[model samples]
Target chain A: MLRNTPIKRKLTVIILLISTAVLLITCAAFFAYDLFTFRQSMVAHLSTLAEMTASTSTAALAFDNPKDAQETLSALKAEQHIVAACLYDKDGKFFAAYPANSPTNNFPTAPEPAGLRFEGSYLVAFQPAMQSGGLQGTLYLKSDMGALYERIRLYSLIVLLVMLGSFIVAYLLSSLLQSQISQPLLQLAETAKAVSERQDYSVRAAKLGRDEFGLLTDAFNNMLEQIHNRDLALQEAQQKLRQHADDLEKRVAERTARLSETIAELEAFSYSISHDMRAPLRAMQGYSDYVMENYGEKIGPEGQQYLQRINRAGMRLDTLIQDILSYSRAARAQMDLHPVDLEKLLDDIIQQYPGFQPPQVEITIEKPLGSVIAHEASLTQVISNLLGNAIKFVQPGQTPRIKIRAEPRGDDLRLWFEDNGIGIASKDLNRIFAIFERVHAERTYEGTGIGLSIVRKAIERMGGQVGVESELGKGSKFWIQIKKS
Target chain B: MAVLGNILNPSKEASNRRFTHRLRACLAGFIFLLLAINAPAQISREYQLKAVFLYNFAQFTEWPPDAFADPQAPLVIGVLGRDPFGAYLDEAVRGEKINGRPLIVQRYSGIQDVQNTHILFISDSESKHLLPILASLQGRSILTVSDMEDFVPRGGMVRFLTTNNKIQLKINVNAVKAARLSISSKILRSAEIFPPAAK
Candidate 1:
């Protein structure tokens, strides 16, 4: 029943229970001893009374005087506990009785052997009256056990009182002393509760003594100290991480700005260099034509052939420079996209160049080619370069067959340029679109390497993708995809 | 004139007197025979009781050291006159001891004949000489007993009195004390004291 009570109450209850048990046992033992001894002393007392009455009555019995014996027996009246007494002659005849006029039936008809015994609630004694070392008569006495019962009642009261007093004292003492242990534990509990509730580890329990509770408090404080320190260290680490992230972001932004400025300056320098070199080349071409026409007879055939070689080299260099300029322009141009008819663009391109005439090359524009969203100028340059490469890379003396078509693909339009040409190897396919990378030898193909590079850059700037499908010694298929209008 | 005439006829008168005397003697003998049949049993019972009383006195009374010749001497109960108890007193004290002393019955012809006696029952035959007998045995520690009237008043220690067919005791405490013999209170509680208290 006491389990789970506060420590103080539990201690008090335990002490009270132990003391009550001990007191009850001790009182019970004492009560039993008192009852036993009281019975014994009662017997002794009755025997003594019987012996006195018997001794005094002996002379009366011997002298044959009933009155004297009666008087002797009457002395028992002074002892209130003795209820009745009588005397018998040596012949065992009833002689005299106490209270002189008491009924004969009150006395035994005959005397029993001399001894003391308890009969029900009475103590009875039969003592021999001796005279001259002869058995003169017997003396009989009966006493009530009222005194014994009275003593028992008194002892029970005393035992009960003692037990009550002892229990109260035990309770009081335990209540006072239990706090010595419970106080320290309660303080530690409060400290722990505070730590959890606030998520703060700076609080400590007060040490009340140099005991186990004190040691527990010390350990608790030490744990709190470690937790507090770790919390601070974690916060410091998180703050340092945030600062490093901010610095990295700032450095990346600064580097990106500087790189973009350097790229603009390099693009401007290349554009001006290409533009200035073109003026000089144009002047050189005019003067060479003038020399050929005016001094035709005086110069002769060898000088004229050398002038023609110089003129051809100058034209190739000019084409190479113009391809480089076109590549650079494709890389840096701003695109404005709108829908353009693929069939119309293909027809215009075929008519613009005599190289695309029917006797020279077969150009078939698939009718109803889908229109797409693209930068028109970049799309024209990409298609023109693809058609030029198709015609230039064909087998010797074979008619170039070019098939141009467009198809709708999801949200975009795909344009295909199929040509019968000397195809590229699989290993060199990936590097085909790089600037100045010519797969065929200059003497055999007679072309600059930047045309495919310009085509790829112009398509990427217009937000489209371009790829090729070709096998060696067979035709190649080049396709580009752009959003459909 | 009639008396002078009877004197002339004397023979006849003497014969008449002889007849009357014989008749009286026969009647007396018959009465005595009847008394003899009844009195002896009563007297024997009385003395039997007195003999037991004598034995009892020895138990209840304590004598000085000089009362015995030695620690082992027998307590002698002496009869100084006609021994009324006959063998009854002997029977009462047979195989009995008082404080480790054996008890014995003795008969004395005179006061001088009483030697080493703790108790002496002076019979009615010595009633005439009781005063002198008690006086002569004054300094001695003997318990002197008798059934005579005024025995305790005359310096006898104890007396047996018969009243209403029951025997009772009267003790002279003064005489008992003077003899240096102490009677137990048990005996005193049941006895009449001499020199009765004044009302």
Candidate 2:
């Protein structure tokens, strides 16, 4: 029942309980001793009174003088607790009684053997009346226990008063002293509560003494001191980390801006160089034609052949510059995409190009080729480049039979170009789509190496992918994947 | 036949009267004996109580060392003049001792015969000689007791008085002191002290 009481109340209750028990036991022991002694003294006092009376009355009993004996017995009235008394002669006959006229029945029928005893509520004595060496008669005395009872009642009152006084003092002392232990404990508890609730480790309990409680308070404050320092260190570290991250982000953005500016300048420089070179080459080709026509017999066959070689080299150079421009345009152009029918685009390209006619190559378009979302110029460039490569790379005297078809994927359309050609070897396949990379010699293939690079660049700008599947001397299958309309 | 029956009738009547008188006497004696057995106080004859009183005087009074020849000497209770106690005084003191001394009853015809006696009881016959008897025993430590009137005033140490059928005592403390004997206060408390306080 006392488990949940506060420390202050618990200490006070413990002290009070201990004091009360000790006081109760001490008072009880004293009270018991007093009662025992009181009874012994009462018996001793009554025995003395009885012996005195018995000795005095012996003359009366021996002389057979009832009046004298009555007078002797009546003297006991001065001692009020003696209620009645009588004398018995040597013949054991009742002789006289106290109060002079008390009835015979008020006395015992026969005197008992001599000595004092307690009978009911009275202390009775039968003392032998002796004179010298003779027992003249017996004297009987009855004293009520009123005096002993009165003593007991008075003693109880005193004991009760003493107990009450002790309890009051005990209570006062406990209340005053309990705070000595409880105060420091309560303060420590309050400090701990504040630390937990507010996450503030700065609070500390005040030390009240050089006891264990004070030591505990010291320890607690030291712990809070350590924690507060750690928390401050952690916050400082976090701030530094955030500042470093911001600085790194800003430096990256600055570097990326400088890199893009350099790339644009380089592109402009190349474009201008290609445009300027084309004019001078055109003039050289025109003058060569004029010289050949007017002076054909004067220069002879060697000069004419030399003029033809110069003209062919200029044409090849012009094609190489144009392929470079196309590749750069494919890389840098912004594409606006819309739906275009694959089968129709393929038919137009076939009609526009004379080399793709029936006498030069056999081209077949699947009737139901799917539509794709793409930019028109980029898709046209990509498909024409793929077909030109297919026809040009064929074995000598083998007619290029190219079949074009489209298939639908999940959210996209895939177009395939299959051809009978001298397919690329596995080792050179990865290098084939790079700028100015050609697997066959110019004398055999007769083309610039920029065509496939332009095809890959244009397809990527249109949000499509390109790949090829082939085996040596067997055939090649080229495919492009774009979003289906 | 009628004259003969008349003569026998007188004698028969006389004999019948004699028998009835004997029966009446026998019944009266029996009832008297019963009363004596049942009530000791009522049956105590005057001297029988006086004999007991003499014994009590021997018990309650103290004698000087000179009153006995030795520690074991008999405490002699002497009767002067005619002995009124008969064998009753002997019966009272028989097998009795006072302060470890045996009690012996003696008879003295006069004052000169009262030697070695601790308690001297003067019978009523010595009333005429009470003064000389007390005078001669004056220097001796003897407790003198009697039933004679004004016995203590006549220079005796103790007197037994029967008043209203109860035996009481009158003690002469002056005479007892003169004889070098002491009476217990217990005896004095239940007795009347003489050479009365005023005197």
Considering every candidate listed, which one attains the maximal DockQ?
A: 2
Chain A TM-scores of each predicted structure, in the order given, are 0.53, 0.55
Give the TM-score comparing model 1 with the true structure, all chains together.
Answer: 0.57
Clash pairs, candidate 1, are none
Clashing pairs in 2: none
lDDT of 2: 0.83
lDDT for A201 in candidate 2 is 77
Candidate 1 C-alpha lDDT tens digits along A169-189: 888888888888889988998
Tens-digit lDDT track for model 1 on B37-156?
543454466677789888888888898998788899999999999998999999998998877888999999888998778899998778778788998998999999987777887889
- Specify the highest-TM-score model's number: 2
For candidate 2, lDDT tens digit of each residue in A1-485? 89999988899889878988888888788878987898888899889998888887887776676777888888898998999999888878888888778888999999899998889999999999888878888999999988888988898898788878877888888889888899899999999999999999778779898889889989888999999899889889999988998999898888888877777677666777777889998999889988899987789999999999999999999998888888778877789899998888888998899998888999988879978899988899999999999999999999999999888889989899999999989888888888889888889888899999998988888888889988889889999999998
Model 2, C-alpha of A177: deviation from truth (Å): 2.9
**Residue A431 CA displacement from its true place in model 1, Å:** 16
